[model samples]
Target: MKVGLYFGTFNPIHTGHLIIANHMAEYSGLDQIWMVVTPHNPLKKKSTLLEDHHRLQMVFLATEDYPKLKPSDVEFRLPQPNYTVNTLAHLQEKFPTHEFSLIMGEDNLNSLHKWKNYDVLLQNHHIYVYPRISTDKLNPEFENHPKIHMIDAPVVEISSTFIRNGVKEGKNVQPLLPHKVWQYIEHNLFYKK
Candidate 1:
């Protein structure tokens, strides 16, 4: 099986995420797209994040209807500040029958050189890049890499940060998130200042 891993905190999984995953599975060669719930992203600040479990639950709620999209808790058991290369290595070891590909936005691509062990990641793994505003393509470090595939999906600028801010300001997030997820967020009062 060919699985595309779309790793993120997913503090509250939104419609934009679902749309992108659906598009990838429908159009791309990937058999599955796992929305890997990162316990903690090394590159991001932790102060604004909700509990990891809550984030994972939101991801579960948002993606439950899509068979091709899975909410992965792989990073929950791994060491803190999860690194892409480390998770990929562990996933490959555990699921040797499957081929795992990295799914990321163009913004991440521009900063590919800064990721931990990025060299190994580019050399060994396949990457699927989706366009994001204000971000350029991957630099020459991956220029010769045959495994990289670029995709153009509809860019919805809705982010977890925006959702959180909306909730905090008591704004309606019904349009941004799935119904169940929005209910969960409101019930728990997550991100409310």
Candidate 2:
């Protein structure tokens, strides 16, 4: 089986996230797109993030209806400030029979060289990059790489930051979130200021 790891904090899984996952699964030639909920992204601040378990649950709620999309808590048990290389290595070791690829936005491609062991990652796995608004074109070094597959997945402008800010202002973000996920967030009063 081939899987595309869609890694994110998913402070609250919203419709945009689901749409991208669906697009990747349908067009990326991958059997599954796993939403790997990172406990802590090394490059991101942890202050604005919701509790790990709460974020994980929100992802579960958002992806429940999609058969090809799965919510993964693989990073929860790993060390804090989870690194992509480490996670991929662990996953490959644990599931040797399965092939793993990475699903990310073109924006991330610009910073690929900064990631730990990025060269190794590029060599070992396929990378599916979806277009993002305002993102520059892929760097020349990786523009025509065989392991890099550029995809034209639908790009939604909505982001978790947008949802969080709206929720903090006591605005309804139901339209931006999955039905069950929004209900859970409202009931739990998450992101409420």
TM-score of each: 0.92, 0.95
lDDT of 2 by residue, 58-113 (tens): 99988888999999999888886668999999999999999999999888988899
lDDT tens readout by residue for model 1, 15-66: 9899889889988889999999878656677777888889988989998889
Kindly provide the TM-score of model 1 when superposed on the true structure, using C-alpha atoms.
0.92
Question: Model 1: how far is 132 from its true place, Å?
Answer: 0.5
- Which stretches in model 2 have alpha-carbon errors above 4 Å? 41-45
Candidate 2, clashing residue pairs? none
Q: Score each candidate by Cα lDDT.
A: 0.87, 0.90
Model 1 residue runs over 4 Å out of place are 41-46, 135-138
